[model samples]
Target: MRRFLIDAIVYVRDLALGFSRGWSRFFFLPADPTPLGLIRALVGVLGFWSLFVIGLDLHDYLGSQGWSDAAGAYDAMPPFGWSLWFYVPDSLLRVAWLASLAVFASMAVGLFSRTTSILAWIVIVSTVRRIPIALFGFDQILSTMALYVAVSGASGRAVSLDRLLKRWREARRNAAVVRPKGARKVSPDGPGRPEPSVGANIGLRLLQLHLAFIYGMAGLAKLRGPSWWTGMALWGTMNAGEFAWLDFTWLAAWPMVLNLLTHGSLALEIVYPILIWFRLTRPLMIAGAVALHLGIAVMSPGLAEFGVAMIVANVAFVSGTWLRSLVAGRDDEQPALRVLYDGACPRCRASMALATAADPDRVVEPIDLTAIDVKTIHPSLTAEACLRSMHVVSRSGKVESGYDAVTRIGSRLPLFRPLALLGRLPGVVQAGRVAYNRIASSRPRDAVCTDETCGIHPPVSVTGAASRTRDSSAI
Candidate 1:
């Protein structure tokens, strides 16, 4: 048992490393495109805004009465009588409520990210404390988590007006430092010297650790539950009349099927941590989680909102690299020869280098055909043939070669959407592959172009001449 536990810990650690490495390669290492950056900005804004609204509601609920008073008031009211709580507000409470909303909105837009985050946390905590008895588990979880995240400083990466202002200030400072040819020499460590922000890094690490702990705790909680032990809890919950949005009454007639589903849910909940911990099993585990959430949504009406939210949160389980690939484009669009080269090259390292240089956020993995163990990862690739050209293996295990691999990689790039589409035309794919092969053959095996030369350049034309330049340089 001890050995098994040790193995599990090691497996999870490796999985996490791989997941983080993949994301770094895709999103951070590569040159990020404007649109992808915008999407991230939007997601961040929306996430923070949602927290703000929730905080406002909590503030309103708390200001009218104390926790004990609220509980007594709730007992006096009939079921669904809590609607009355929204209308009545104390004078001092009304001011605080409005202030909380304003702060939340400011934080959402990232006006002064660090400052707004701190204020938002204070407002949320105050609200939670005021009406603790009225708060549901989900409400408490969301508010507490938001407070934690706000203080931890997630708004730093998310596109915000504050970041734009900071950039403008820095640019001005840089311009001011520039001098005419005869000006005195500046010291090496001048006033404008860039320093690393340890605060940002520390905050990011804290958020990652907190998210991991949440997952661990949730898994452990399920293990201690009676439903998980008996394999009947999930079934009962699903079949309960209160949650029946869909007519799953038909499913109840099938006892064997119900038993299977019940057992599967129990097993999945119990083993989720272990599965997520393993590199080989992480993808499967994520898929299972999605399915589980979908099931909860279909059978339960009120639960769909919670289920979807949880599923979105579980997105942390997915490698950033994989998420970027899915959002960027489909895999069928790659050039052939580039795919071959990718497969023949080293695993994660070379691909990651290219990805990080191209776009920091949407990095895709390149296949490594050189390893003797490549067959285990990709059974279809024969060791002898994989060496002949550049190859790329998609997540689904489909292989592309030469220019096709370039096209595939390009397709995953937000900036290269038009070129990727053009590459898919019948004769264009073959022509591109032939051109890529010639270029690959000309370059010496030991020579490698820097990212400046080999990375995809900004769009030149719909004809894909710019991509061709980068593809040729990769050889």
Candidate 2:
């Protein structure tokens, strides 16, 4: 009995440790910021749209003469309801509304993203609170998106003017420094990738979980209604005077089709909160969500933005790794280019790792010339020449070597685009060639591994990622 108790304690201890690790990984793992940036852009655009419509009839909507005056709006406030419109005098209503529009526009394009994101949330929530009479599903979802986007602080990391300016600043800093002899040139995790952040993960996970909760609650609410079960709830929506766009009344002729759609959608919503958490089922659930939201938009054109806003909220489920590659014009199965390097050379392996580590963007495929036949990768790449400098091969069978190869890579990476542009200046390319040649020629190789088959690189595993051995002849 004592032995059994000891074993039980050890099992419990192991289970607890495993659960803690999983919890940390789910909430704190460093993630790419691209998806957060996308969500910000979508929310900003919707916020701008919301403000623009209000701005056109500022006095009629938000001013003293509006549907819901400041007095009533303030009186109707929920416990913590706050809105700047209440403080702004009627004389400055238009000015305040226009300023709110500008804030959303700036947030959309990611200008002063850190400051603008916070301002955007305030603007959205304030406006929504001020117009309680006109509020709907759109206001609710839009404000929710703004809240999380503001919290993330990672929305400007990609596809933003801020990113462009940052790259320029980095380029300027690099220009002031000169490389010493034998110094290698490469970005630690590929130039195109932004740094991973725990903050980004926190924001994205919150948004994802919140959206799941919403769908679960919505499904439960629908279950309380009789129309949803009879599959006639859709028919009611089809004939609704305020929401229906066209004559979906024809769906009445096919009762079975209506049943399929209504029941399927309801079932999907009910299962989404659970299934969306699983890796294998995530894609199906997300796709279903896209269909459901798009269907709502099509059926009720009046509430199109609300449908779109909810669909955009679902964007949080997207894998950061996949989003990064998609932005770089590649996917896991297809890399943009293959780079041949001498694995036996310490400088070469380290430089290659820097240029394409962790397979960021899935853009660069590093082929060790020592491990595989050079001809298999590219007819132009000979082991003798690859030993001297790295070579890049395009899918169309074009090949570039040395300085040309490095810059060719830069052309595909957005972070390196600014440098690529500067390299186009008449003397810049020539000067860069000289510098690259100097670095390449001085790169140190392994002391014992002198030839193509030095076998210095053992096929060791990294981060539990299986080291896939390539069939040299297969390529």
Which predicted model would earn the best TM-score? 2
| Alpha-carbon lDDT of model 1 | 0.50
Residue-level lDDT of model 1, residues 167-270, one tens digit each, is: 43443332223233311111121221122233333333333344445556766777787776665666677768877866666765676777677677656665
Question: What is the number of backbone collisions in each predicted candidate, taken in the order shown?
Answer: 40, 0
What's the lDDT for all of these models?
0.50, 0.75
lDDT of 2 at 360: 38
List candidate 1 segments past 4 Å from native.
Answer: 1-60, 65-89, 92-95, 164-230, 317-475
Query: Local error of candidate 2 at 240, Å?
Result: 1.0
* lDDT of candidate 2 at residue 429, scale 0 to 100: 81
Cα TM-score of candidate 1: 0.47
TM-score, cand. 2 vs. native: 0.70
* Model 2 steric clash pairs: none
Give the C-alpha lDDT of model 2: 0.75
Pick the lDDT winner: 2
